[model samples]
Target: MPTTNKKKQKKSSDTAVQGTNDSSVVSKVSAASRGYFRDAFLQHFVCKVARRAPLINRGYYVRWRAVDHCVRRFLHITQKCPKKQILSLGAGFDSLYFRLHADGALDGAVVFELDFPDVARRKAALIGSNITLMGMLDACSPPAAGPVSISSSRYRLLGLDVREESQVEDALGAAGLDWTAPTLILSEVVLTYMETQRSDAVIGWAAKLLPQALFVMYEQIHPHDPFGRVMQEHFLKLNSTLHALRQYPDTSAQRHRFLQKGWEQCACLDMNHFYEGLVPEEERARVERLEPFDEHEEWHLKCSHYFILTASRGSLLEQALLAPTAGPICGPHRGPAALGVRPTSACLEGLGMASARVRPDQVLLTGGSSRGGRGAEARALIRAQEGWRSVGVEPSVDLDVRLHHSATPLPGGGVVIYGGRSSPLSPTPGLFKVTFDPCGSPAAPDSERAEAAKVRVEQMVCSGDPPPPRWRHTASVVSHTGRDFLFVFGGKNQSEPALGDGCFLSLDQQLWMKIPVEGAAPVARHSHSACSYQGGVLVFGGLSGGGRPLGDTAVLRPTDGGFCWGRIDVRPPPVPRYSHCAHVVGGKLVVVGGVWTHSDGVPGVVVIDVSTRSSVEFSLDTTAVPWPLMLHSFCSELLDPEEPELLLMGGGGNCFSFGTHMNPRPVTVDLKPALGAGFPSWS
Candidate 1:
């Protein structure tokens, strides 16, 4: 009777241990699922990396590369196949199916995932609870309540204990998995938890089920090594055992296990080799620089103890799995180039200003402050090459220091500088003509070209009374009545409120005439953006008289002699801000950074479709910029019309401090695929 009691006690102890192990496995899966979200939030991955620990983020990255490489290889090899399928064992809460669907890779593929009952149920609940995740799945039919298994058009989630061969077969059958299709089986650090015999049985079962399949496994190895021992001990302390690691001790043993278990061919590689050799160098560099890292020793040790093993039944599958091992199949492409800083002897600064591309490789920059000083009445010629170089800084004008000025490029050549603040308490209402003579005689012997580049600035004597002295206005040169006219609109005079008036200075007649409008005019505002578009001027976002940021948009259509104003209703308008930069590109208004209140508003680029009244915002990688301010003067030029590479230059930093000055270099943003052209490139 005592012996019988001992047997009962032993059985009870074993059952308790089993229950604890099951809980630990689920806990580990939960932790990894959380890690994915954390990594995404932090931007560790191109998709997302929220706020994950650096070590965990980096580790996850390595794991992602291994899995992605195998999947990509499978897809590449089976491109000609009519049907392709992927089965993931112990899938946990992975979002691979959704990610692939987003990438458009799941169009002709079937994805099936199997996990323990609890883990599968929890993952399904999480997905069902979140609208974002649920929307990714093909919701042809309503999901069942409290479902432990779910099926979509291209994805299926099922629950089954991988150790139980019968249950695994039943789940696959119920999920309608195609065993005859070219299949890729993924087992990431899952089989390590099962007994060696159970793992082997699972492997053998897959090999027999799928005649043309590639089984890729990622898990720990070399449990007897010093580093491996530490890893094993860590898992042991977590109440989890590396049961399969002792059986497949290293990559060689792993390969042998696969080949001996009915796999026609097998290949194995440690994570260290996989990372340094198989992963593209460019991709590695990009993620490596995402955050500051100093865990070389730990990284190498951890990677060295893990291995990626691929076993295949068919020659095509074997070749596909081994092809990437030779080298990276897909290397990273070069991002947009910075093209170096804008060459300037001194920094150009101001709140509202102008920059225009007058020549193919040159832009004329005028009327901005230098360092902490007020706007210097000077013009700089910027030449674009491998790097931007200030080819010449013309002599400073004798005119008063000006800020919030307008420099409109003439149709013939040269620029007309209009009303601006001459001093803190004064406004310069007079128009100034600045011309550069490329063929003029030499003044000095520095060089023949340098001597020929002569600049002449002179104040214009108009025929009629000009508009009252005002600053923070917009000016654009438009063709009106068979001649060019400089149109100025909406600004503030000293001690006055914002003005809603508009006027045109006829270059041919040398006469300033008041612009009579027929329709509703834009509200009185300053620091708004205006660009000539389709024989009209499009005005957007500015600061109102009450110092409020305004998001109103209007257009001034050229009439027989004067102008007609019409307001535009934009859906999902951009954030209200002033001193933002805007340019007409591809029938859309591309608005860059701006200032809101006392802070930098949106640092991303906002593209608005004028015809459709729709808008989309693309956030800039903050790491790419020197500062976080929006009131900087910037000039953009579309270099490639087909690819549409827009190069943006000269923007001030977050603050007005001496250190947070304008950036000298140019940053290129590609407007391809997003704009229905191609993918964006940034340098």
Candidate 2:
């Protein structure tokens, strides 16, 4: 590269990297404003304060929480020492020093923050101008010529490029940093912006200089998955690419990197592990209850791609190491080993749509928001001589707008649709009955059925009590007194954390009916799966009230008098997941793709043999799928009762700030290999 061009590129890169600091402080302010954390200083750094989406707020909260955890741990362990210090790399408008001082946690520790010269000057100016901020600092002198931007007894802000080791060392020495003290070095989403070689050199330099230091870092990882790819692209577009993601891609790799960089003891965990195992449960629930959040898929995916690590050289800091509060996650990441999928031309795609087989050859899909907005018309996927094709149908009556609804196939015929909301604030009321019929005779040719499928949708008005307006619930046909009833359970509304009470609607009368039940009920949840099993329904997996994924399985069986709930234990329990689809065929519960907190990849097929209480998992090979097959907030159904083929359609969510990813077309998953040869055909 030419010298002139190299210099220009470097200048542009530095500007772009520094620009990230502006956005970071704004998000932190948003998070703190929403009670996710307590930070009075961040608001002063931003020009204007604005509210962020719940997902973004939660993301920043975890980042803030992780750093606080490290800081507190380090302070407690080194409290007895006469003098200790904290060195924050790329601190960029962070108020950690002020926050610690206000909390009185900085009794004996001094905090040194380093960033670019421009950023340091900006931060120093903000501090000098604000009366609230000025009160926190001991007498400080204005920044002038050298690397030291702000000088105070407890806080020293420096402007030095971390890539230049000798300059940083000399600057720290001049700032009165104690080299041999029990120092805590913090780097949150930093160091990844530079070239790999530069970042590695920085890490090595810190380890060599501070023998009794604890290095803390929080940054992105797992750069190969769909979410990861989007995250990488988001940064690349900003002209600040993440350099560490490819090499230090996971917790294990990150741990090894620090160890190889001359750190003696190190521990690393993805944010999901930190949030679950390390943070207290009550506090998590409190944060969750602050806002009405429905973006479980994005929250978990965002957490899995970031990590918190602590590395120590001396034994004093070893006690501050991050350790898991619980055991290892159950089941291997199942197989992303690529289960074969047959390509299909089914064009129907949208999240929160409901799918059910109205006939052996016809599947009805209704009521979901699409790129064009909430679909007013219904669609039917009919099997033809060539293949399954989706055809538009005009319903007899408007079902209105529905998202995260349920479509239950009736034993006698027709379908029952219930419980969905157009948006978080508007849950559709009452019941809907949708029936699909072939255009011609009952024995019409497959080609003709594919040409023009007819659908009828009607709102069913009933006399008995109906469940309150809600979405993300499950509805299934369970038999009682030789009559099938639409059993509805587990969902959330705008105000409730989650709805646990189950209600039964008689299919024969279209009236909400009550039947006797026994045993403990499942916890309040939403976005789970329930399928008909032996005249009852088997429910599995959902998001709990505390915003955690659930993996327990239970059966509501038909006793002579009513239904009874009983737990079903499967060895090597499937990893807890939510926002996925499920179906029962030949006594096996086959769970399809969904979002999980497992560190590396999305989940695949988890087939639980309900009869034997055994389970197996398989991964989806979307090699032929058109786009990234995000399978959550989508719908799936068995194309044929006798075959192991399933169709997944209409998923994708707002991927944090990366962008919205919606599966463009329907994809087929062939589960023959996942379910071995001897499986009996579905009758």
Candidate 3:
């Protein structure tokens, strides 16, 4: 646990800096002059963008590459540090975690993202379920921690405004983290937003809080070059789009202040060297020669606009010196913590406030947590709140019903639920359907609602024969010969001793037939993920009864009368994992978060991509033990039509040491829209 010390500091003024000095100005400034300053003011702060949208495209690639270089270096140091506690101070939706999560980089590192309340809220919404964040947006609200899955754990997003010394201390103290541990501190594109002196005080406080903590930062060195002036002007003009930029270091004198605050001056890497590393080797050589602005421009003299700096906590003398006579530090903001907020434990196990989808213009909900028996039940209970409505298909016979995972809606309107556990009382053979009549409006009349509800199951059934009695399997609807078919593969049957495969229930036939899998078949397994593309079902990763996980990849082609299976040599096999969700975005199948243990014996996510056949891993940066989760459930949605990003949600976490993964918490991830060549096409 983190040690607490009682310390207090007096507050100072937070008055805005005056733009005009007492210069004898006989004439009023013109509108153009006023507009110039306005533009610069707006250009001063953080600009918002979609989380996965490449920062490279936004012209922040230079800063981003610098950040990555610094982090990679720090991670090397952290890899040496026994206790890896990563704190992203004023983390402004930085994609560091995204890249880390993509590669499963932080093993044994407990990452804590700290920011002001408003910023934390936005980060939470955008990074929803992608990385586990720590701090709660509304302390009064229920905990946001979802079920722990085998592959991943929740992260904390602590609301700590750097300006508020007390709140900063409070959040740190509450984290129960060991300050003695070697920590990596990141302040990216943030200090410039704050008064220089305040930034210094924060640095001083951080040094005292964790003397061994290493700092990595990127800040705009005061730009006087024409380019620099334009950049500043650009910010000021788009004030609504951009926030205020506090004092930027114009001379080396300003950079000297950080060292005075107890930072051990480390190496500084420039933007050109950084971005040159990102592009292809051939392009990189060319990129290095390219200038951001014209040579004739004044801004061209401002050394690439921004610089990446690394420092360690030590005597300020080892680094740059502070101003001989530094200004006083300002106190915290006077207003309520922008979005007023206020942390949790084992009730027992691991978590969502509501299970239903919320719509715009919906009324605020105030209710208790309802563990609805099935997905439909959960959705129904949550949708009962005013302003939200539910549309879901319950498994014809319940075993374990997952609302979003097992069931998906067709392009037209009908609903499909496959691979649900069959009831012990009455096992289902396979394949069930419920057709929705949106045209038969529910608001029309009681008769219409009855008629819509009364549609017979047989009428919805297709011509193909039903598959076997298998639960804990995967099924997806793919189009073949201009018709949609529910493709099923590899599931455990209560009756059959081993996992089975290759069954297709034609939406048009309604019958279920066991596909005669030919060629090399994937290993017999259950709980594996299956996705439909073109006229094939791609299967990956699952566990056999022997308890060992399988890493086989196979595709089932729907040709002839039945489906045929073949193993396409995935150049590399993913690490054995189960309960991970798979989604086809663009043409890549993203296999996200699955269970794994650290060298220190802690559980977290181990992600792998078969397209490249590489192992990626991420660990919770905080010490909080996530619920041991596996096999609870998972669901995916193509959130944006244009981008093709996938949103993954809901899975169980393990609460007991029963040695089995069973988390009931919901996890989420909004992946980068897949891009590239040789992608599959769906009919």
Candidate 4:
């Protein structure tokens, strides 16, 4: 239900008989598809959970914290020192202004939230006259900027569509905007809901309206790899609940357009890389506690989707960030693809490798597997590559085989290895961690390499209480209360004989708590995929008991100390599939193909809208899909469109078939538009 009418005028051509026919047909098809996907994602998220849970809370905490980071950066960039006029476009239910004001990060700053009349009304009721809300009012329907008094400050709320150039100008005039002063504008998970042209117009207006302003925004970008395809699909499926889900196929290109329109600077970082930089010091010990999985050590790469960008009236702050100061990144990351190098299918798209990390010059890796007879030889081939080398961590040569998934570099010179699934009957959960650092690089000397390998174990924490253990369970790092927070979503639960509940760990507090969410949470499941977009977690498609499939989607948001849950409304693709991979590139969730069932099946891929919660089915034609089934073994990473070869190692898929035991094999899938060459570029 609720809806907002986009401003679109009928063209004279529409009156032509032939043009009318074509338009009518297109509208019918689009509407039908939108409904299907919206309901489908909602089934997964809301239909299943009735009450808030820890998983949902943690997911919200993760996304909200990310938004908070962007907000602060915007303030610093525009205000020239973190003090200035701030506006939240389409404020929705955003509580950042309130939270930040309460915490003192922005006690004296003038804050304004603009949204639809209804949303603004609800937000006012939820937090009224609470000092933070002193100058806050619903501007969704404001005829003009109306003045309000907050302490000694005077502010006004302007209800106008950013898409309308004249309206924006009027609102700016009414708000007493001074072009000479720096301003910070934030549009979080909002633009993707509008058409590309409209989104572009909004960006264009912002660049031209203010003299020195920074516009920090988050939106969906299309993926260009196999894992990306899978990630895109699940997102569409989960978002099918809302009818107006819009996907931005080219977020980077859009950024360029913003620059062309007048933004002086722009920069973006994928989710994994962003979190790696935000984690605090204490978490470094938690990351170093476990050893790298045998399999994880072999398949080394980082997989993440969401992208954060900061554009301003001045040059973007590209080279000013401090170097890694915390610990090693969790998954394996070879710094951004070397400059000027084009990528292959193995590489992903949408990740601006260069700006995402510190010291992107180094090739990062986690682990891989040895095929029969090809054991040493295969590894030799990998090592021989000009920019490739085996990860330094060793597997536990004893029991419990290790499967390396990915690694993330920490602020401090350390690496956090996340991969490995403990056996079902094993005492602990499937998740594991490892660290390697503080030693010179392998190029330093043999002794240095050995010293690096001899890393000291710090802190190890595991449990079946809050969030049970499960391989491939999605995790994201958030900053809150001056510390890094780790939030985990759905995955298999070896201890509970089912998928575990979601959990979050506070590095500063040294505390781990289960996320309490309402509405609906996914059923006890495993191998499900999750990505955070728009201040919420989008989880779709997974495996349940009896080998049944799950195509529903659930979203978790933070409320008080617990979490709130809401199911997405999306329509399943031609078939209901699970074990697929999901990633958030740009602002959309990309879900790539995976086993349709326990038995043989084909790759199923789709894309979900994070804002409106709708799905768009993309038909991809490929050679015979991978043999055997992959469960809890698939991973995906964001890629820059220009370079196709820099694929982040998605996790590995395991086969339980009773055949010649086979080690994990790395597979690369290409995403091409089925029936067509590729997705249509944004208008």
Candidate with top lDDT is 2
Q: Estimate each model's TM-score.
A: 0.45, 0.93, 0.37, 0.41
If ranked by TM-score, best first, what sequence of candidates would result?
Answer: 2, 1, 4, 3
lDDT by residue (tens digit), candidate 4, 1-683? 22332212222211221122222223323322332111111121111223222222222233444566666665554444434677778655444554565455563467765654444444444444344354443332323224221112323444444556676676566555665556677876566545567777788877777766777765434344333344445434433111112333443565576688788776655443444466453442333222222121111111133455677784434332223333432221111121221122222111101111113323333333333312111011021223433334443322133332223434444433443343333323233333433245435543344345433334345433444445545565544334454566655433432454666665445467555556666676655666654445667776664334566777766655566778766543323456566666655566765544211123444666555555555533333434222222434444443332223332332111111222133333343231122233331
Q: Supply the global lDDT for candidate 2.
A: 0.85
Superposed Cα deviation of residue 338, candidate 1 (Å): 15
Order the candidate numbers by lDDT, best to worst. Answer: 2, 1, 3, 4
Best candidate (score: TM-score): 2
lDDT per residue for candidate 2 within 594-641, as digits (tens), equals 888887477888888877777777877877764667889888888766
Query: Against the true structure, candidate 4 has what lDDT?
Result: 0.43
Greater-lDDT candidate between 2 and 3: 2
**Model 1 Cα lDDT, one tens digit per residue, 1-683:** 69999778645533443444344333333334444322121111122223444455566677777888789878888988989899998776666787787777765888998877766777777777766677878843544443237888788887666777887786677667887889999998788777689889989998998999999999887675334555666667555577888777877789899988899998888776687667776666656555543223245446657788888987667584644444322211222321222233333343334566655545556665655555644444444233344445474466566666777778888878787775535786568887765452223332444455666778788987777788778888776667777888897776655888778888988898765668988889887888887667899988776445677678888788667889777756666667677778767887665544211213356667777776665655535444332324455555555666565655553220013244545566656533652232222
All candidates: CA RMSD (Å): 20.9, 3.2, 23.5, 23.2
lDDT of each: 0.65, 0.85, 0.44, 0.43
lDDT of model 1 at position 339:
20
Model 3, 1-683: lDDT tens digits are 32332121111111111111000010011111222111111111223212211112223434444556556655665675566677787665544554464456676666677765655665555544432332212122333332111112324566556778777777665664577777778876566656556777887887778877777776655343223344555444433111223343332444465677766665443342233323345443333233221111111112245556667764421332111122221111111111110001102111111121122111111111224332223222111223223233232343243221255455565455554432322234434444433233423443333234321122244565456666556767766567776776676554543366666676666666554556776877765778776577778777654323456677777776656777654433345556556666544566654422101212223333445543333332222324332322444344453554333233442111111122332333323322322222222
